[model samples]
Target: MSVISAIFVVLITILMPPAGVFAISGCSVDFFVNICLTLLGYLPGHIHAFYLEYVYYDRKEQNRLGRFAARPAPGVYSDRIQSGGQGYGTIVEDPLVQSEEGRAGATGQ
Candidate 1:
C-alpha cells in the first residue's frame, strides 16, 4: 500500500514536480487507498479519477502548484529528499528547515 503509493507518487513527482509535495502531504490517503486497491486488485480503485483530480487541481492553481513543485534550482530540501539520485524515500523532510545549498549551484546550471 505505502509502497505502491510511494511508487506512484515518486513517478508523478518525477514527471510533474508539484505532485511530489502533494503526495508527501497526502501519503496516508494514498497508502490507504492503494492498500484497498491492492486487496481488491480485481476490482481495484479508480486511479484514473484520482489522477484527473490531481491534474485538474495542479493545472488550475499553477501559482500554488509552483509553490508545491520541485524547484528547477536545487535546494537543501531537494538534496535531503533525493535518495542517491534515484528519488526513493517515504518520508518527506521539512522543506523549510533545509539550509545547505549543496556542492552544485541550483540545478548545476
Candidate 2:
C-alpha cells in the first residue's frame, strides 16, 4: 500500500475498525473477525485491524511458513546450502544400503 492509502486506512481504522480491515483485506476471514470484534468492542476491533493491516499484512500472500518450504512457482530448484545443485531436492542413496545389496547379490539370494 502507498503512503496516502496507508494513512487513509489508519484514519479509517481509528474511526471504524471493521471498515478499515475490509479496505485492506477483501471479504476474508480477517474482515469477518473485525466485524465480530467491532460488535464486541471498538478497542478490540481497532487493535485486531491494526495488527492485520500493518504488522501481519503478508503482501505476497504466499506461504506463512519459512523459506525452507517448497517454491510455489515452478522453476529450477536451487538448493545451494545443502545439496549445492540446481535440481529438485533429491535424496542421496545410503552407502551402507548399497554395500548390503552388493553382498546379498554375491550370495545369489
Candidate 3:
C-alpha cells in the first residue's frame, strides 16, 4: 500500500470502526458500506465512495510511463509499457499455482 493509503486507513480507523475494517482488509468502502446499509435498510455514514476505475487507470498509467523511463534487463520484461526491455517483451506473466498432486508429479499441471 502507498503511504497516502496507509494514512487514509489510519484516519478511517480513528473515525469509524467499520471503515477501519474495510481499509485494513484492503476492500473498497463502497461494497462494504453498501452491504451494511442494505441489510440495515437505512442510509449509512458520509464516507466517500471508492472509485475502482479511476484508481486502477491512474496506477496503470503511472506504471506504463515508468516502463519507458526505466530500462529493463534483457530477456526480462517489467510489464510496464514505458520502461521495459524488448528481450523479455517487457512483460512478465504471473505463474499459476499448482495443486499438491501436480507438484508431486514430474508432468506439468
lDDT of 2: 0.61
Q: Against the hidden true structure, what lDDT does model 3 obtain?
A: 0.40
Model 3 CA deviation exceeding 4 Å by range: 26-109
Give the number of the best model, judged by TM-score: 2
**TM-score of model number 2:** 0.51
Compared to the true structure, candidate 1 yields what TM-score? 0.26
For model 2, how does the per-residue alpha-carbon lDDT over 1-109 read when each residue is reduced to its tens digit?
4567778988999999988877766566667878888999988898888776654233222223322224322221212211211224666566899999999999999
Per-residue alpha-carbon lDDT of candidate 3 for residues 16-59, written as tens digits (9 for 90 to 100): 54464444333444446534653564224322222222233344
lDDT order, best first, reads 2, 1, 3
Instruction: Give candidate 3's error at residue 5 in angstroms.
Output: 0.5
Please name the candidate that would achieve the greatest lDDT relative to the true structure: 2
lDDT of 1 by residue, 3-64 (tens): 47656765765454434544543443444444455456522333522443354344334533
Q: Looking at candidate 3, what is the lDDT of residue 41?
A: 43
User: What local distance difference test score does each model get?
Assistant: 0.42, 0.61, 0.40
Better of 1 and 3 by lDDT: 1
Which sequence of candidate numbers ranks them by TM-score, best first? 2, 1, 3
**Native-to-model Cα distance after best TM-score fit, residue 30 in candidate 1, in Å:** 3.5
Error of 2 at 74 (Å): 27
